[model samples]
Target: MIKAILFDYDDTLVQTRKTRYQTIYKLSEELFGTKITEKEIDAAWGLPAEEFLLNLFGRFSSDIHYLWSIYIEFSKKDLNIPHLNAFDFIDKYKNFVKFGIVTSSSEKVVLRELNELRVDTNLFLQIQTSDHTAVHKPNPNVFEPIFALLKKENMNKEEIIYIGDSPADYESASKFGFHFLGIAHDDRHTSYFQTGEIPFVRNFLELEEYLIDQYSFI
Candidate 1:
């Protein structure tokens, strides 16, 4: 029986595609003096911000902070774009199933968005954010603490499932032996995750269908 469900932030629970696009576009122009296309932003979206910056510009880049600051400032303003249907749908399971959120976003930003969106933070049993771990998604370290927490709750990996909208999220779940559900928050990102043949749903309504079909209610 499933005892827990973990969710990913950003596109998985909220709409941040335009915010990501704008941030990457501005950073590309300012940092590299060249513009990045929408495809580039989608490809880099799964990567940690600093890791993506270093991978693209290497260690010699002088203003990585400037790029990140601009990105965060713009992203913060994007909190008002709400997608609460997923939360409402999940609430049915929330009563009997433990809920947690694991995301690459920083704690402050996630909290700000949650409050602005009127999402009660207390609904989740745990919320793991970027600031909580040095390593980000696609790396198991970010999820290690989460697993430990669930383990302490007497839930094994098989009893927990992860739902996310990015390749990193899928990869990490696979590496750690958790069942994974992918959401096509963005076509391009979903395409990337689909390459691995992970199961997917386009929206929370579809997700509700999936849960009804694949999982039994407690």
Candidate 2:
């Protein structure tokens, strides 16, 4: 039986993609003097923020660092993006199973967002962010801390589920032997997971149903 669910922070736990794209695009023009298109940003979605910056800007310079600082400052403001049904989801099943977060995001931003959204971070058994690992998703090392923690608790790989909104999440979980579940909030994710024959859900309600029906998560 699945005993835990590790979540991705950005598009999976919260709806930050569109707003994030807008922020980056606007800042790219202002800071880099390059008017990057939303399409370009979309193409590089799911990468770690610094890697995304390097991928677009072709280097990680002082200006790139400055841009990241500005982005973090911007994130401190209300982007008006509502978190997903994670609060209710965790509250419902938290007693039955452990919860964790594994993301290619920074700990500072993730914690800040969770606080701003009024989520009880204590409900999580562990949180492995980019800061917690030297390498990141699609590389499998990003899951090292969480995976080790689970093993120490006698939880097998099959007993954990990794839920996220991107292919990188699926790839890393697969490589590391955890079950994968996709959050397909848009056509791109839906089509990608469907093409890969991966199981996915449209929202937390459907996710609840999927867990209950498929994993006996009741």
Candidate 3:
């Protein structure tokens, strides 16, 4: 039986494409006076947000630190990120399966938005942020800790489904031997979804139904 459900944040559990794009565009304009196109910004969606900004603002990681800090301050103001309502489904099955989050977003940024939305971070069994590991997703190393944690719970990768909205998440699940459920509304990973090799849900509500019907065997 399935024993755990791990999720990707940002565009997966919460709607963040617009906010992420706007903040990056704003920061790009402020730092280099160049307005980055949506296509340019979308190209960097699944990677580490800081590293993405670093490349855009120039290779100087040192400069990215300061610029990203300023950008964080700007992000917290009026960020209208909507909770995707998938949490209720998670909570419904809370007693039977472990629910957790693993995301490329930094702890500060994720926690800030979670708090601002009054969402409880403690709902998950474990929340792994970008700061938790040096290697990012699509790298099997990033999921080693999660695998170990689930092992402690006596669950195998086959009994866990990883839900996300990015190619990185897709590859991570494939590499790590977990079932992957792609969410498509973000459209950030649309090209990756074009293959239809993996199962996908267009929105959280559909995902909830999928989990309820498909994994009810748990």
Best by TM-score: 2
Per-residue lDDT of model 1, residues 1-218, tens digit only:
78998999878888766555665566667656887776655556666656665555454464777646665676665444645487786666678889999988767667877887777888898999877788888886678888899999999998988998877888888788999999885586766766767799988888877876898746
Stretches > 4 Å off in candidate 2: 30-34, 57-65, 78-80
**Residue pairs that clash (backbone atoms under 3 angstroms), model 1:** none
**lDDT per residue (tens digit) for residues 1-218 in model 2:** 89989998888888788667777766677766878877888777767767776676665364766756777776665463655676788988888999999988777778877787778889999977877888888897788898888888889999999999888889989999999999887776787898999999988999989998898885
Error of 1 at 51 (Å): 3.5
lDDT of each: 0.76, 0.81, 0.79
The superposed Cα distance between candidate 3 and the true structure at residue 19, in angstroms, equals: 1.0
- Ranking 1 against 3 by lDDT, winner: 3
Model 3 compared with the native: what TM-score? 0.89
All candidates in order of lDDT, best leading = 2, 3, 1
Question: How far is each candidate from the true structure, as Cα RMSD in Å?
Answer: 3.1, 2.1, 2.2
